[model samples]
Target: MPDSTPRAPVLQMPQVVVDMKLPQIRELATQLRFAPEEGRIWMDERRMVLVHSDTFADLREELLASLGYEMTRGLLTRIYFAAGQRDAASVLKRLGPGASLKEVLNTGGRMHALQGYLLPEHVGRGLAAGDLRSDDYYGEALWKDSLEDEAHVARHGVGQHAVCWNAVGYCSGYLSYCAQRTIVVREVECRASGGNHCKIVAQPAAQWDNVEEDLRFLLPQPVGRRARIVAPVADGGPTTALAQSAVTDSRDDDRAAPRSLAETAFVGASTAFSVLRHKIDRVAPTQATVLLLGESGVGKSLIARQVHRRSQRAQAQLIEVNCAAIPEALVESELFGVERGAFSGASQARAGRFEAAHGGTLFLDEVATLSPTTQGKLLRVLQSGALERLGSNQTRVTDVRVIAATNEDLKQAVRQGRFREDLYFRLNVFPVVVPPLRERRDDIPLLVQALLQRFAPLHGRGHVGITSRALQALIHHDWPGNIRELENVIERAVIMLHEGEMLDLQHLSYADDTLSTPSYFGLDDTGQLMINTDYDFGASQSPASTSAASPAALDMNRLADDLLRQGPGQLAAMERALVRSAVRQAGGNITRAAALLGLSRAQTEYRYRKQQSAPG
Candidate 1:
């Protein structure tokens, strides 16, 4: 159930203090490009160019004039949300993984100050009632030369409501990036509104009062001006902008827009994906046994790695074992290790997966494949954190977190007596269902861009991209193979693609889905027949068209000549197509199709299923 009670703010009306330790601020250089992580300010030869505050102020005025208030606010909010996320990430990146949360927050605040958005005077720390990490952060800023505020004041002279739309977005984006949750910031008082300074309150999604209003600012919207795709730099570094991908639907709600938190792996924006990621992060820190359930290409292994990366045992190695790949007889020895001189060919004692994964994670892919004896042993290990070597009687203690994955239904297996009911209950303590690629279609654009970036260089193809139409086709197609299938398609295209060519429809090849609907093939009296290539393949003719031209009257020599000209592969393809056409015309009745094809019923059914079973 969702938490119903309102979560109190981490710090409300925090007291300003002196001697608050701040990170070493980097000196301003010629080029002030935002880092890819968005957490730090760095300088690169081919880096981000710094702009004067006046430039931002001018842009704000122009946007307001052309796009109106809400639209302008939405645009600027998205822009700064990205900037803030980068800035927060930059802070964390520079500080390293060991840096304290306070350091990260403070450094992020200081970076915004240096960027001339506002001077952060004070910040609030500590956790709220349900705060998972030290994520709920609050701070106050003195609006000194604030671009949005200054722009608003110049145009409408101190209005009733606050005018720091950009700043609010920046704060929300930065904090949200830091917390990995939706954090909205609102300006209760502002300098442009005749207030002394800007006072803002920040909290989680359910904690804030005007959350709907603030959250609206962080939503995504299309730009009125023509957009361009920013190619990677000469060094092959990718752009960090959220809106840089292909054209998006105007109806895309901000609440449902891409999060742009895609790390080295795993990317998506749909609600199904968002929930899956949240569940992973929530369970990663603990030593809970996780059972990942999904279809074969749903990226369960990747999720397991994510869990291990975030777990307390991250410093240790993550040992993986494919239960189905191992021979049934060797499953126990592989998992429990073997002792020297204990069995035939047991020359030396060796540690098994559980021992190797001590103090870390053990990923058992396709756990349902374990035999009854192996399953009993696994249960014994789970019940007691001890295991005996295959050839030895000594029981050694092992500390390991088990994360099991499978494409099959374990509950059904248990009911059928194939799997242990106790093991299912134990592993199902944290059940996560990884959504297939088809379910998260909104993520295709980003996935395509990411796949190209990662694969192009490896195949010697320079930075590449996809056309809009090709991307739309990819989004509409139901990916039965999921991410793995998409990656395979992209990689194959990359191999054949030219140095700088973009991947369009011509490069993408899908299995044949077109099924011919016809009973038989025949010729007309005039040796010409009608069939629409668009609607009809002329795949096969009907009895009405064939009755006049009997088989005895046809030219056998010409038929043999045609078959000889086409190779075996082509002949096979033609035969399969004809078989499919017959089956379809017969309404999928095997005996009827066999009669039409002059073949046995078993032969007809086998061929039809085989042709239909091929990937499409």
Candidate 2:
């Protein structure tokens, strides 16, 4: 009687990349940029506008009243489904090249968090590294703080059905785009239906028992409410996998779209970049000698490339020479062609950079470092496109457009007699001053994204996100070494990160002076000078707190003393008592009590309920 029956074995979930590391929450916030002066808010390249939650609730209530529940659900689901598809495309484009399939899939959750939809936690495993296109693929996730559920519950009270219709549609569309197959993500449990939190399960459409029921909402019109089936029926025809293969085979002539040069090479959307671009365009078509002035590592070379690309001679070769890198004795031969036996070690005749760049462009970087003798030769080439080969006075006629760049002041060099004034005038026909990285702080996020895409694959880190603190640090730092220094820091940080880890502040290596923490001096209530280290100031003060002493400030030292006096094992009891007192002070209003306790309403309610149930 005790033991003849066999027990069913517990089902095990399939393993996937559950430990997907995300960018720090703070870092995600930095992606949203406010430009009140320009009357715009931007999240990456996309424009965004903030809308009140109550406004959304109003819309939802109106829709429910007008269209009825089923129609409203279908309408909202299809709308959000389309939005999710766009989000998928934008996110994939933003992550850029070298991003792994896992990163692309994992970032979908981050995208939800970024848009204030919900926070997704994988229940057992994530589908980040799994085969998303598989017919039997299944993914389970728990959603906390779902905005749609909260809105629905607030407007309509507790619903009889799971009410996260938007989330379901969004996840379905997003996953479908990423997997290139119809993925039906159903909200199995929702707070509006009296569940603790929203829980969702996703599977390829064909694998779901009620796939038609789930996808019917995605169809248009009144038919969506009455339709029993949708396209790609669960039981008939070829599977999504076979269909995808057929499509792929038929699209052999289709190619990936070309990326913009500005997005890939000269990534920036700042006003400063726009102005620079305008200047480059103005002079790029002309034969005027261009001078690029900027600090070292400020991407003068990239500016030069942009100019060359936009020029009439773009079809020909572009020869670049770093004048400072060559020896002073070899500068003349490097600029002007050299014949055999021109120098003691000269063996064979070779064309100089100018001859090599015939009917093309010759970019001279750090041109200020060229010797006076070499400057004369450069002036001759710029004046008449004529140059003499060293040790052979045969003047070589060549047609070339010169684009010179330098970190040093060429005018000052001319004044100092290190460079010829005539040559300086010739090179200064159209001077383009590239702004430093610090001057255009708004462009930092774009640059960081580009750098991450470039360096992550080189170090085999796949796609690494940066912590919020790290991004804040990058934004605040005055990049004295300019873009080049930023490149080194990003590449080094990528190298330091292990697989499945985000780049953090600790991984960054900056100049000692740049990394130094400065002390702050402020006047306290009595106008007496008060000094605080940044650490103390930031740790002690909240963003809402003013310079004056705040009554709500926590006396950490006193609290610790009291805690020590109470000894161990009393922390939980004290917390319960504190929560209970806060509830009483707020007259049992959980929302007000949560504010008093500096906790969320849900948290305060949970604790108060727990305390009331505990035995005394």
* Residue range 1-616, candidate 1, lDDT tens digits: 1112442221221122221221133211111323323232222111244677778888988898999989888888877876776566545433445766666766666566556666565534421223424444444444344566766777678868788888887877777766766676778878688776667777666766666776677754322211211122211112223432211211121123332222423665556777887898799999899999999988898889888988999899899999999998778889999988777877888899999999899999999999998888898888787899897889899999999999999999999999999988888999999988877766676577567767776788875656433554465567788888888777877887877676765576544431112231111212233321111112234434432333222223235434554556667877887898898899988899999999999999888888879877
What TM-score do all the candidates reach, one by one?
0.46, 0.51
What is residue 111's positional error in candidate 2, in angstroms?
Answer: 11
True lDDT of residue 412, candidate 1: 99
lDDT of each: 0.64, 0.68
Clashes of each: 11, 1
> Which candidate has the top score in TM-score?
2
Residue-wise lDDT of candidate 2 within 18-79, one digit each (tens)? 33232233223334544454455555444577788788778888999999988889888987
What is the lDDT for 11 in model 1?
21
lDDT of 1 at 504: 62
